[model samples]
Target chain A: MKQILAVDDSMSMRMLLRASLTAAGFKVEEAEDGRAALEWLDNNSPTLVITDINMPRLDGFGLIAELRARDRFRDIPVLVLTTESSPEKKARAREAGATGWIVKPFDPEKLAAAVRRVTH
Target chain B: MLSALATEPRTRRHTIMQGESEVSSDQRMVLSTVLGSCIACCLFDPTLALGGMNHFLLPTPPEGRGEDRGEAERYGIYAMEVLVNAMLTRGASRATMRAHLYGGANLHEGMRAIGSKNAQFARDFLAADRIQLVREDTGGVLARRLELQPASGRVRCRHVAEHVPDGRPAAPPPSSGHVELF
Candidate 1:
């Protein structure tokens, strides 16, 4: 099974992600913030990193920058799952090495399709 | 801010109905709305003097309910995203954005707590996006009337008592009734 790391501060959102991804046949690891995500990444390598943009401490942008800076994590695809869909935000995510952008209230089927596309 | 604007005549006023959003860079425009078991988010970027407001009926579309993309703005997820994007179109940046939340009253005692859920969604959305939430007035059993000056980031919220079947105003529960500053 493909492994994924989902980072978000909202418990409800995390639960939704877990339920949706697990049902989609992927094993998902969870983190509350970008800092926690980094801590998790230190010991584990997931096929993909899905993150929320705004969070306490380190945010998704910082996390992406950190991932891009390190050789080991640099190749892993990062998907931004956020409520923001502005052109500026999207460009910034791409500049920071994001593989894709998915807006919030994502449909489970669409999200699964996105994951499969990136992982494959 | 509300008090300071009391005497200044608002040049334009727009009413934001439920499931609608409006953004403006004009300092003269003020957005107003009324809420019950709903939420209104006021977002402003002081640097650009641009802002927007959204009134959503629910936190997210009902799971597995076949919500289409066109009507997604009725939910918090799309409402907030659309509002932010609208502000950005007017040259506002997220880094300098500040937010204020209002409404979310559980007026119906025995029914589902939709109001609290909406309020929680707003809080989570703001936190997840790293927007600075400077003011919030949510929960309780009374509806609210809100006025927001998007460009100036000024807000005024008034808690209105719920009306009973007999048409008399219902007394507020002891735990509620505090005013939120702009």
Candidate 2:
């Protein structure tokens, strides 16, 4: 099974995402915020990282920058799942090395397709 | 309904759901709810002392889920329309309407940004209907608890913390299953 790291501050959202991703056959690991996601990254190598933009402490952009700075995680695909839709925000994510962006309230199939697009 | 009505002697508090809306001419009637990614639009007419509120989870329902599913209320179009119609029925003139929008938080990371979409939909919906948007607090990471006084058109917003402090027991999750309020 492919391992994927899911990061979000909302427990309900995490539960929904986990249910969707697990149903799609991906093994999912969850972190509540960017800082916790970094902690998880220290011990685990996920095939892909799905992250939300706005978070306490470290945010999605900060996480992407931190990951890109490290050689081990440099090439790993990072997809931003956030409620932000401004063109400037999307540009910033791309500049920070995000592989793709998906707006929130995603269904199972849309999420699975995005994962497949980035990982495969 | 009785509890909300009983409290009406002083102040009436109404907690509405995703597809639900309420309109009132009473200054003591306060409408409130906690939102994750959904959008709540509050409409009020100063001249008529009429106010209304609606909460919507999505901009539009899924393609195949038709009106018979009773899911239309979950979409912005239906929610906004219902609110406007209710206000009109209560003697609010559309020409004097003003709007205040809240919610649309990106509470969950690594998922579609439904909150932003909902907020955008609200702005467009209001604009298309020519309702002046007087106030807005939307698009953030924190979930919010919002209260609106329809008659006075006053609003209060409080940010909800995402996690309980270390060693503290978390609040019990809301019960699953449909709860019908009569």
Candidate 3:
């Protein structure tokens, strides 16, 4: 089974992501922020990373940049799921190397479809 | 703003923040939000007496700006879709749907014209979907406080800014706080 690292500061959002992804037939690992996500990456390799932009320790942009800079995690696709819909923020994420962006309050089907698209 | 309407036994006022939405079938339910550059789209279906409102921060997602589709769903599109879907799930029909748009004020100087873009996007979306736009108050230099009674399809918009950038006093709200739908 493919594993996905879901990172966010909100416990509720994390739980929702876990439930949705698990229901979609993927194993899910979680982190409270980008820093913890990095720590998890030290010991595990997820097929993809889904993250929120505003987080403590490290934000989504920093996480994507860090991952892109590292040879080990360079190939993993990163999807940003955030409430911020500003064009500036989207461009920043793209510049930082995010594979895709999904706004919050995501549909389970669309989320699953996006995950499947990126993972495949 | 909603407290005044709470006198009714079944009336519930809900304040939605940015990137959020609410749908209700109760005739007394009132939805409210504060807006600057963000927009609030209130959609109502008179046939079912059902309605919903959504607040979104931007006009489009990354793909709208020529980027790859890449799993993007911007708040403007997402909020509208979600609200409309919720209303439909509750038995509302598209043919009877009506739309009201508020906000899209350019609250700051020398900034990107996000407010106008957001307002235009809402207009285009409603037009494309063949939804009737009954009313609109958009594109100014001040923020606003908006309230909508979904089932009645009545809306009240009040300027929240104390003064305009040109130093003129802001316009006063309607003497009557509410607009009754006949």
TM-score top scorer: 1
Predicted structure 1, TM vs. truth: 0.65
Q: Quote model 1's iRMS.
A: 15.9
Query: Arrange candidates by DockQ, highest first: which order?
Result: 1, 3, 2
Better of 1 and 3 by DockQ: 1
Tens digit of per-residue lDDT, candidate 1, span B57-135: 8887676652354445567765776676567556666578888888888888773588899999899888876778888
- Estimated TM-score per prediction? 0.65, 0.51, 0.51
DockQ for candidate 1, please give it: 0.09
lDDT of 1 by residue, A15-56 (tens): 778988999999999998899999999999999999988776
Clashes of each: 1, 9, 0
CAPRI-style grade of the A/B interface in model 1: incorrect
TM-score of chain B of each: 0.82, 0.81, 0.76
Model 3 interface CAPRI class:
incorrect
Candidate 2 residue lDDT tens string, B1-182: 00111224578788867777788878788888777788889888988777888888788767655222345556676567667656755666556888888888887786348889999988987876667888888988877777777777777777788731111111211221111111
Clashing pairs in 3: none
- DockQ per model, Cα: 0.09, 0.01, 0.02
RMSD of candidate 1 to the truth, in angstroms, is 9.8
